[model samples]
Target: MMKTLICNMTTYMPKGYSTTPVLFYLIISSRHLEDIPLQAKKCRNSKVELVIVSNPEFIQELLPSAQRTALLYHLSYLCLAKFPKLERILRERATETQLLFGSSEALLLKCAATSQNLVSTLLPSLKAAVEKNKSVLAIKSLEKARVWINEIVDKVEQMVKRYDKHNHSVASCTSDVLNEKAETEKQIEQASKEVDALEKAVIGLNQELWNNNQEIGRIEATIARKNNELQNHIRESSNKNNGLSFMVCLIPFVGPLIKSIHQAQANQALAVKTQAISNELSQLSNEKSNLKNKEWNIHVRLTDMQLKLATMKLEKGSIPDPVHLNDVQTCLTRIQQILIQIKKFWEAVSIMLEALKDETFADEHFIDDCEMKETFLKTITTAQKHWRSFGEYCLSARGIFSLQTKDAYNFLETSPSSLSKEEWKRQYDAVIVKLNKICPEVCTPKETAAIA
Candidate 1:
């Protein structure tokens, strides 16, 4: 179950990297993230990477040494490269969301769901852009998403200034959900307990599955290597046995040649080893598939329980509590949805990019491969990746969305500022005065003096 894990990003670089000569050509690269490391970094707001980093010895619980190390390094690089100011983005996330949606947690969930739907809907377009080789379409697709992203990023600054006064948490608006509907209380409590237990099981199962998949990968890699060795051994034996005089094999020290004659015909030991490894791999794969099904079933049950509990709370009017929607599932909703773009980009990458593996340079014979190194530079410097990252960042702002709709409005009404209160009174008085002047109707802005 051990794998020689060699993680290389070079294989998944943007396509046609060698078509240009300059190391820094104006890259018209489309926004795409077809790389594993990149996806992992973006997944779960980089919690996946955090897990790997925290559990260094957890390689034994996941991938082998080389795979884990490379994955960690690559994911770390991807995160740093894509999300330069991660901490800042995360810190102001909630308040900025509150400004746009006006203390509505439901708005956040809506946006998250909407963003996910958009990405899902746009996937075919993304794939088509790559397939048709229409770079313009790809650019335009990203540009449309870019508008929303910029709006969010730009509006956030103003929102922070606008909503700072209301930043303080509201009073107990959710006492109803927390302490209401006595009959439903038992059902909610039981569901909650069940959800908690199922969540733990799912987490444990997922970890095991991850580790199992890694082991399967290792076994498959070993089988491939062993198969190649077997063929190479037979081929070498045949070559040595060829053009050698029969009398040369009659010498006293020709033991290897005689053995080659037998090995050239059939290497039983190598075959047996490969078969055993192959059988182990097949069994492991089968087990992994079965457990994966079990995991999904448990996940479905957990989701059902969670939904029932949430519905009960919503009906009881306790959803105004921020904690109701401020959980990992909500955070993942945005991240998980944005991950679709990665899949689309990956499809394009796999099709358009040639995986020129390391063996290309095995002989130290550098052919007309001059532009290859520079092309690698293109993958590094491409703005396409940046655009893709930005789009995802924008969509992921849906994380700011929640289910709380009552809290912010409550703050604005109960904790109105002096400026706001005075402005409202002035407007109301002017309206009344104008109504008196114009036979009891609305006010004109110039009628402020008449109102006084």
Candidate 2:
């Protein structure tokens, strides 16, 4: 991941990127190297390229993938080596593009997708111009682009093949980080679901507790009413017994039998009913207590789950997203495919130029009326027809140029950041305007502007 505070990428990397702030090397001078006299005599005959690149180690890297993708990593360290603000913009864009599209292949696809319209429209006209009109400038321009593109692509392929071992590939290293992030997300989701379930359970238990409390209150009220009714019934029975039993006292055995039968009176039956209701109330009270305990346990679980989910989410945020390595085969194939079209397209133009340059022999001996002269006229007409076919070949060059493809695969050297026509120029200008509070290049350093 780009955000990782990593050391030298890996043991496999032959060299790590410079921690310097500059991006590209500054040229010594257009003329003699006499500005800095300290070492002028010692390096009077040195190659300018070597002197311009003061730091030899800046361009080299042990990681092949890093070499292909160094612009995403160390250009900030080198070009804007001194400009933190500018470096930061590049860093932001790098991070944005990477996270937005997880794979290099996908990014390439995005860049390549826009080529269809160009092929359908612009290329057909260019093809017509080169074949029918025979424009030399179009041929040269496309040829120049093709040559530059081929050399760059070939170097990339070599680098990819050089460090493509199982362990050396950056994909393996970043995979670990990606795996950690994915696992953290999974854990967070599971904990969140558990917390939600526990919360629902707690709510359900609370409702049950409230309902049980109401049932207990109702049972208690019923018991109170039953007791009052029993008391009234007892009073009535006592009054009746006092009158009848006294009169019936002469018949002692009959009075005793009536008293025994009076034992099943309404008041006694009410007492038995109240006792049963009281037992039911006690059972309900026990059930309410059990629900309370269950709710408390669920509450604890919910809190714990919530904490765990938070922790997992935090971990997920900290783990930087994986920076994908461009697909070597696909990129090479795409580049080669584009080059083939441009090459064929331009080759036709080159042949057309040769044909245009070919004068009609400047011969007075050849005449249209003679059979041999007719042959000469027929040759000219046939050459003109073949020129059209060449035009057709050149027009097939679809998506010959792309800003996205170039940005997706930009490279930089050991120089400081400055305005140049390369893909990173716009970024440099934008950063200057953003941080310096002046339009791009308005307050450009004299030397930086000279270099640009």
Candidate 3:
């Protein structure tokens, strides 16, 4: 039977045997065979079965190239019943052959149910490849996330730096504004105090001016009384002369009596002339005292006005109130000009007084009637000229002061910028020039230095 099976396998097992046909051939061949040694089973079984086991080298050598994998698959099935000793070796060699030369899908599909050992050995390597792919994908995703996070961190840091710089600049600007506001407030307070002080000073000056006006009125009244007394003395002396002339003409025969009466009249007239000179000297002394008082009051007013002007100037530096400052300057300048005129008037009066003191009035009671009349006329003309000059000086001073005060008021009412610095300086210099003209001997070194 082994001989017959070996001959049939050799004849029918072609290079292209289907897996089902090859497996059916191995099962039928195994069912007919017995389990015995090849040499002992030669006479008991068929020659076909005996020949298949006895000559394994011949079956191996007869297998076609196309049928080797199918033959191995079929041989593994037969080894389960007829060839048990070759089962492990057949499966190992078939698996190695399929792995090296066959497609993986075809090999796994063909051997899946019958090849448990092959599936078990490959399970670990398949799982490792899948785990390795998952690790690579996770690494790529982490790298992308890290790049985006780094970008966000850099952007946030830049924004923080910009905010810090902006905050610092705002803080600095706020501090500067506060400081400027404080300085402005301080300047306003200082200006207000200065203005108040200036107002008080102006009120005081007005009171002083009123007192000076009252003093001038009293002086004028006293001068009028003295002039009336002088006129009465002149009238009485004229009547006595007319009576003497009538006696001298009517009683020429009684010459000694007329001469005695004439001598007594001459003595009485000399005594009356001495008394009149003494009274004139006393009146002149009182006038001098009044003039001195007026001068002192004017000087004090000028000094106070100048001090107030200085204070106003200081306030103007901060407040810039041009109109008020200009008014103060104008009033101060006019007062200075008036003071200079008064000084000039005083100097002229002194010269006139010195000339009067140097003059020698003749005692003309023993002289001819014409000579006596000539002396009296000359004395009256000199006194009238001096009195007229004093009245003219007072009138001129008053007129000039009134005009200057009106001009100062006008200037104050006008717009401040209308008077340019150069124009104002020119006007001030003109006043100084007029003062110099009035009193050439007056020293003005301090005023010159201040202008400079």
* TM-score on alpha carbons, each prediction: 0.24, 0.19, 0.26
lDDT of 2 by residue, 1-452 (tens): 00110001001111111111111111122233343224212343342211111111222111122222323233232333334443444454444333322333332332233222223433443344333433444344334434443443344344334333322333443454456556655644444565457556646755664665455445444433433343343234433332221211111111121232244354566435434433443343344334444433443343334333333333334332332222222223333333332222222222222222221112222222244333333333333333333233222211222222344434332234443435344554443232222111111111211111
lDDT of 3 by residue, 1-452 (tens): 01112111111121111111110001112233443233213332443211111110111111122122222232122212222223333334333333322221222122222112112322222223223433333233323433432343343334334434433433443344345435544755444665677767767766675676566445544533543453243324333453332222111111211233334365576435534533553454355345445544553454345444533543344222222222222322322232232222222222222221122112122123444334333333333333333333334333433333233222223232344556644544443333223311111111110111
Please give the ranking of all candidate structures by lDDT, highest first, separated by commas: 2, 3, 1
For each of the candidates, the C-alpha root-mean-square deviation to the true structure, in angstroms, is 24.5, 43.1, 76.9
Model 1 residue 170 lDDT score? 17
lDDT per model, in order?
0.30, 0.31, 0.31
lDDT of 1 by residue, 307-393 (tens): 444334444432212232222223223222222322323222221221111222121332223343333223223323333433343
> How much lDDT does candidate 1 score?
0.30
Query: Count of backbone clashes for each model?
Result: 7, 17, 14
Clashing pairs in 1: 105-402, 105-403, 105-404, 106-402, 106-403, 108-401, 177-318
TM-score of decoy 1: 0.24
Give the residue spans of candidate 3 off by over 4 A: 1-191, 242-278, 285-300, 303-426, 429-452
**TM accuracy, model 2:** 0.19
Best by TM-score: 3
- Runs of candidate 1 with Cα error greater than 4 angstroms are 1-266, 320-452
